[model samples]
Target: MEFDEERVALYETILDELSPPDGEAVSSAHFEKELELENAYQAIEDLIRLGELEIVNTNCGHVRVRLQKPVPSSTPSTRLEDFSENTVWLAYIVSGSSPRQRRAQRLFQNFEVGEEHLANISHTDSLAQVPGLEDVWCEEVKGLSTEYAILRKEYVFEQADDPWP
Candidate 1:
C-alpha cells in the first residue's frame, strides 16, 4: 500500500487535461493509450479507493470519468453513489446499479466504444453487472479486445466462449 505516485499523476492528468472544465462526463478510455492493460484497471481502482476519482457508467452507452471538484460550493464526490443525476452528461448508471455492484464493477451495462459497445474495452473493465447474464453479455457482445479486459461480473454465470482468451 505504498504511495503510487505514477497512479496519482495519471489521475491528475486525466482531470486537468482530459476532462473538460464544464464538468461534462469524459470517457475513461482516454487513458487507454497511456496505461498498460495491467495497470489501467488498478490505476482507476486506486484512484477510486483514495477518493480522487469516479468511474461512471453513462446510460447512454459508455463509461465515463469525472473528477472531484474543489470549489467551496462543490460537494466533494468520493464515489459514484454521491453524484446526482446531472443532465449535463449523458445519463449515469450510478443511480441504476445497487451499492454492492458499485464496489465490484467499474462500468455497467453494454456501452459504446468507437461505434458500439465492446468495440474497445482494452485497458478498461467490461460491462458485467448481474451474475446469470454475464455469459450473455460476454458472448453476445462482439468486438471485445483480448489484451486488456478486466472481467468482474460475479453472478454465477454460465461460461461462454470467451473472446478474451
Candidate 2:
C-alpha cells in the first residue's frame, strides 16, 4: 500500500526525537505536535503494518513504539510451545475474584501472584497453546493487573461492558 511520504517523515521525526539514542520505546502521542491527531494515529498504524515499527498499546490507551528492523535482542522468543509450558493458565471467569474477570472473557494470565506455579506469558502466540482456547487476541490487561497480554477470542469484547452485552 502506498503511504503518504510527508506523514511518514513526520512519524520518523517524532520517533527519533522521543526515542533514546539506544532506541528505546517511544509513545505515538509524541507525534501530535507535528501532525494532526488523526494523521499521527494513522502514521503509527501504517508504520507498524509496514513492519517499520512494532507497537504495544498500554491499558491506558497509550501506543508504545519500537523499531521493527534490527530487532530487539531481548524480545521474547518466537517459540510458542516453550512459553506455554512455563505459564500457568488463569481463566478470566466473569464471576471470578480477579479484577480482569469482567474486562474480557478470559485472560492469558501474566503477572506474578507470589506463587512459583503461576506462569507468565512470554508472547501473544503462547496463549494458543492453552487447551480448548482458540483465536486468541493480544490486548492490554487492566484493573487487578496492568499488562499487555493475550486473551481468548471468545472473551474479547468489541465494546467495553459488564456482563458481556
Candidate 3:
C-alpha cells in the first residue's frame, strides 16, 4: 500500500530517535518534537495501520515507534494451544524488603493459604461452583515466610461463574 510521504517521514524520524541499542520501545513525545510533527498521534496511527511502524513502551513518558518490514507467514505451530477461555490465574509478588529473599518467602505463604482455601471449597462443592477450578495447579511459588510471596493458580472453566473465575 502506498503511504503518505509526510506520514512515512514522520514515522522514520520517530524511529531514528527512539531505536534502542537493546531494541526496546520508545516514548511518543520525544518523537513528536524530533519529527516536528504537529499531530503525532494521528501520524502514528496512520503509519501503524499502513504496516510501516510499531509502538513500543520504554517505561518512560512517551512511546516508541519502530519501522517494521513485513514478512510472509510460514507454517503455523500446531503445538500452540489457546487456553484463554479455559483458565483463570492470578499471580502477585510483594515489594521492598532489605533482603529480597525474605519478601519472596512472605509472598509464597500468602499464595499457599489462597490455594488451600480454594482446594477446600472445591472438595466441598462441585468444581462448577468454584468458577475456574479445572485441574487446579500451582505453576510457580516463591516467598519469605509470613512476609511476602509469589503464587500462581490456574483453574478450568465450564461457565462464566466457575469457582476459579
Candidate 4:
C-alpha cells in the first residue's frame, strides 16, 4: 500500500480525540504504536510541519501533540449516494480473528475484470448483505467514482485469479 500522508494525518487526528476527555494531549508514541508504523517519527514531523498537529510537550524524547483543528464526528451514511461527493473508494476490512483482518482496511471496491479507476459502485451496497463486515470507510482520494455496477468482495489489492473466463 502507498503512503498517503493526508489520510495518515486524518487517522492520527481522529485518534487524538480518543485521549481522555479531561483535555489531555495524545502522545506521538501512541500513534506510532497503534498504527504499527516504522517511520512514525518522520510521519509525525510531517504532520506537525503541515500544521495538522502541534507539539504540546516533550518528555524523554516522546512528544505529546494536539490537533490544530477540531474534528467533527460523522455518522456512517445509510445510503451510498448520501456519502460525501469526495468519496472515491469505499473501503473496509473483513471481520476475522486475526488482528490484520480487523485492523487493516483493504480498498475493496469490487471492480470487475478490465475495470479500473472511476468505477461504478452500484454493487457497493451489497457489501452490507455480506457477512462479517468490521466497518465501512469512505475514502476521499481526489474525487468520487462513476458509480459503475460490479460484484461484491473483489478488490485491486489482491492478485487473485478470476474463476470466470
Q: Which candidate's lDDT is highest?
A: 2
In model 2, the clashing pairs are 88-119, 105-155
Q: How would you order the candidates by lDDT, starting with the best?
A: 2, 3, 4, 1
Off by over 4 Å in 1: 18-20, 34-38, 58-62, 70-165
Model 4 lDDT tens row, 104-129: 22243343221232123222333221
lDDT tens string, model 1, 57-164?
644433576543421123233222222232111111121112112222344432343112233423234543222111212211233321212232212112441211
lDDT of each: 0.35, 0.39, 0.38, 0.38
70 Cα displacement, candidate 1 (Å): 5.0
Off by over 4 Å in 3: 1-4, 18-22, 58-62, 67-165
Please give the lDDT score at residue 138 for candidate 1.
23
Each model's TM-score? 0.34, 0.34, 0.30, 0.33
lDDT of 3 by residue, 57-123 (tens): 5455555655432112232432213444443443322232311222212112344465454444222
Judged by lDDT against the true structure, how good is candidate 2? 0.39
Model 4 TM-score?
0.33
